[model samples]
Target: MDAAPLAARVTRIATLVAGLPALPPDDGSRYSPRRLTVSWLLEAESVHTEIAHARDLGAFLDWCNRERLDPLTARPTDLAQFKVWRGAGTGGTPAAASTVARALASISSWYTHLVANTDGGVTRNPVAAVKRPPVNRHTSTTAGLTLDEVDALLAAADAQAGARAAAAGRTPTGQARYLAALRDRALLRLLADLGLRISEALDRDLGDLSNNAGHRTLRFVGKGGVHRERPLTPHSLQALDEYLAARAAAAGTTADRLSGPIFATTGAGGDGRLAEPNIFMTLRRLARIAGIASADRLSPHSLRHAFATGAREAGIALEDVQDAMGHADPRTTRRYDRDRHNLDRDPAFVLGARRASRRSGNQR
Candidate 1:
């Protein structure tokens, strides 16, 4: 629990992780040491939401290597067959269409990486042509918690806090209460209010929050390496300020330097102490406690969806929602427009049709 030795270990881990290069300068035809280092980092971070799914990603990569299905040379048929192979019962049940689609997306991104790093003449992305099962474009309502559900989740967290304090043989009436209720309430509110991807929130640095001339904005690095700024609401800002204060006190530090992680592990680093717990882990725990879904529905991405749905209901302009969601294509933004679903249920459609038929019968 000593600060000096704890800081030293943190420094050592950072040194090792920081030594990794972002990407290879040249193509993989000529493997450089720097390329190897970058490769190692990519593989290490490949431990995604599911290790089993990540293994499938590796298998797909291996398939590409064996088939020599380079984007530069492979035909559409070849790509289609590869997709079929992925879903076929080669050993077990066929892979889900959604899973196959996800793998294809990852492969498409990998191809984009290749094109960016080397030649830019990979004319076609075959994955674009592959016909898969129709995907329901509707965002799932099952995952996101309504306002009432959020209240229930918050209550559950408070109850857990009480149990913890009781077990510690102390009155549940001091820092313990603040740590449990305030810290986690702020975290959940940030997710719901901002619609921040868990990773985006986790990746937040102190400098990401800025106030200038009485306006507050939270800067975030979004997907596809895009940087975005979202105006912070008064409630969000207040919660953020309180969380920051509590965080500083917990660390036993006073300097509010706009550097270092916005969030970090409590206490000293050890075998159990996380220098930085993965944001996804925080989401999973929260979901488990809140009883959100039987399957995994608690992640940064789910929160992002919840934000989009909330905005749609609030009658925010589609363009504004698109910008908030950090969507590249307007068509992708169009998908989030829940207006169409409501329009589909209009009485005009059924009533107008019946009236027209009745008028036609009279005319006959």
Candidate 2:
């Protein structure tokens, strides 16, 4: 095979992977092992997952190119070296254990697909013989907001919306700003209230909101393409209603007539769906206005962390919280709870409380 630029190879691989299903059925004669392997491996994955896998694999392919090694025929020793290089940071800063683990997982999945689909063309997965970094499942490194911080963030968003609303009728610019502020307020409320993944929240359409058993609920396609519904809290519903009303007013229509993205750009020609970066920037700006100490590091996920931690601290059962967060594994939910290992909530404290109560009863 001819040596190709890394970017070109990645682009070609992505195109091939996306087009695989449309190709007519044929024997192994048509495609290269690499193309067939990537296509089959990522066929069932969502677009987001496919892109991530491609990126991770692309990094490894780039490394192989630099090392004068063929990725398809790479040995265990080659993978071991690649792992060390990746962990040590292709840049100056070392990658996190979880990141390295994910990269290795992507590579391993690729080789596994090749071995399974190619008969005896590939003997084994080289990544199988390589040791992977241990990922800590009990905790995450993403910063979490406290209940007070969550309140402050909401207040900040509300204040901005209020200010913008006052000027909305004056000019077109004012109306646009007011609309955007309303959207931001509602988006923040939903994130804090529901702990939705940013992607899940952004993917919402106005039509997704419906009455389920007389309760207002949001239907979203969550991780793994699972359809899930979460009942909206009164506060979340109110925020959403206000935003929708404002959006409809801006469009010279009623709230009932509005449809499409729940959070959309204010631009006239832009797609209605709000991008993830927009939410990220919005959160950081609100965090700064809220005087949060971690304002610089604040992200939309911080509100999700706040939801999980606040719910757990308020004595919500782990299983219930896990269900609300749409986590398949309780451990993943636990990772979002900042106080999962808090000493103050230890079983010893519960035991001590019971002992004290028993002593009082005995004296009585």
Candidate 3:
């Protein structure tokens, strides 16, 4: 195999892994074993996951270049040093334990692929010898909104929509603002009520909304490419209906004729799907309007956390909450439950009561 420069090889592999077009090999030969392995790994991952992996891998490759270490030939000690550097706040504030852990996992996966496919060229995975930082699975660091804050946020969205709708008759830019407000209202409702990841909500099309067994539901592709449906609450359905109505009015068409993205962009000359940054800005703006303490830090994930936490607080079954949040593991769902530490529901209390009852029966 031809020895390509490490950076060049990484670029080509990342491009291929992202399912993007890549330049032909310089010698017009087959791809190297490492590239082929990356392709295989790409098969099971979503585009978002592949992009994140590429970013993490790029950071590691840059560090290797700076240290004069060959990633393909680096030893266990080299990986250990890299882990320390990754968490050392070299660029700015130190990375979180979860962030460091994810980076190591990315590097480990890369080596695992190479070791499995490179025959004898790459002997073993050095990352395996490095200990990863312990991440707490029982608690989440993501900002969360209280149930009252969520209600206030929804009210703010509703107020914005109403104001914009009234202004639509007076100004040229008012129609666009009105349409965007309507979209934001519906988007927030879905996030708060259904516990959808932002990507899942943005990926929805008009066609994804349907009636299932007398329930109105929105179908979305969740993480790991799992197909799932969430029933729309009455509030969500109403918000969606209002948004579609406004969209149809702006487009000079009927709502039923709309066919593309459910939350299409409202910017001039842009009719594509809504992007994550747009949603992030919307959330922050609405949160500020709602007077939320964590407005500046609010993201779509905050609503997801709120949904899980609120559901658990409402006495919803844990398994049902897990399914709603699309968590593959119950423990992951538990992590989002802010009330997980509530001693009122402790099993120890029940066990102690049982013991007391047994002793009382023996006295009788």
Q: Write the per-residue lDDT of candidate 2 for residues 217-275, one digit (tens) a residue.
A: 99988888789999999998888899888788778889898766788888893227787
lDDT of 2 at 218: 94
Off by over 4 Å in 2: 1-48, 117-123, 166-173, 360-364
Rate residue 166 of model 1 by lDDT: 44
Q: Would you estimate the TM-scores of all the predictions?
A: 0.63, 0.83, 0.82
State the lDDT of candidate 1 residue by residue for 319-346, as single tens digits: 8888887887767655545444677557
Q: Indicate the worst ten consecutive residues by lDDT in candidate 3.
A: 20-29
| Candidate 3 residue-wise lDDT, 1-364, digit = tens | 1244335545656565444222123332244544654664455344456556776777887788788777778899999998999998566889999989998998788788777776766789999999999999888898878899999999999999988878886775888888899899999999999998888888677889998989999987888778888899999999999899878877888899986779998877435778788888999999998899899988899999999989999989999999998889999998888777888989999999999999999999
Ranking by TM-score: 2, 3, 1
C-alpha lDDT score of every prediction, in listed order: 0.57, 0.82, 0.82
